[model samples]
Target: MAHYRASESKREQFRRYLEKSGVLDTLTSILVALYEEPDKPNNALDFIKLHLGAAGPDPADVEALRTEISELQQKCEALTEENNELKNKLMQCEPAPEEKPAE
Candidate 1:
């Protein structure tokens, strides 16, 4: 019983270490990209080799920002369309009475 517990603990520790070692994040795509493009900007090691930190626009981060910008632009377009639709509906609706109601 104690032996199994010890083995389980060791396995758990190994699993955690493996996860931290990036078996979890699975950089397979990044590695493949690096293999395809040696000069590629955001390979796992490229950042460290280039001493990238506290500086602007890491390549990976820029790609993420571009994705975010695209999402925001879509949202803005959708909102604008919705706003125009609401305005058109408002224009079609009957207007409120100009005169005050009797007190």
Candidate 2:
């Protein structure tokens, strides 16, 4: 009997904590939005996880970012090659000055 009462008290405290934190309201709102979706998700848990940002970024956005990064990397490589080529040409054009012997 004592254990049962303690468990109930703990549950009530947890419920109050959830209410105070607004977690109950946020969860209710998300669930309500999911309920209203016309084309409901096959996996309700996945939908909730996605909405909660636990599923990472959208695939299309990730792909777009990857393409942009790849293009930038190529551009950077080309610029580096061009810079090295220019430096080599400059070095070839300007001969090193003769070193003087110590007196």
Candidate 3:
């Protein structure tokens, strides 16, 4: 009897924790949205995940960012080559330092 009472107490605490944390409310809202959809999604899990923002970023946004990164990488490579060439030219123009005679 004492063990059963302890289990019930733990369950109550967990339920209260969920209620206090707003998780219950968020879940209820998502379930309600799913319920209200007319043409229900084929995959209910995916729908819930999408609603909860766990499905990852939008594909179009990801593609756009990838394109931007590629362009920036190409530009960086060009600038690096130009800088190396300039450094080489500067080295050629500078005279070599003469070594001092050993004491």
Best by TM-score: 2
Tens-digit lDDT string for candidate 1 (23-66): 64555544554567657574457544344343456789999999
The TM-scores, one per candidate, come to 0.40, 0.69, 0.65
- lDDT of candidate 2 over 14-62, digit per residue (tens): 9999999999998999899999999999999999988777888889999
What order do you get sorting by lDDT, best first?
A: 3, 2, 1
> Which lDDT value does model 3 have at 70?
100
* lDDT measured at residue 68 in model 3 versus the true structure, 0 to 100: 100
Q: After superposition on all CA atoms, what RMSD does each candidate show versus the true structure? A: 11.1, 4.1, 5.6
**Residue runs of model 1 more than 4 Å from their true location after superposition:** 1-55, 96-103
Candidate 1 lDDT score relative to the true structure: 0.76
Worst 10 residues of 3 by lDDT: 50-59
Candidate with top lDDT is 3
What's the lDDT of the predicted structure labeled candidate 2?
0.95
Q: Which scores greater on TM-score, model 1 or model 2? A: 2
Backbone clashes under 3 angstroms, per model: 0, 0, 0
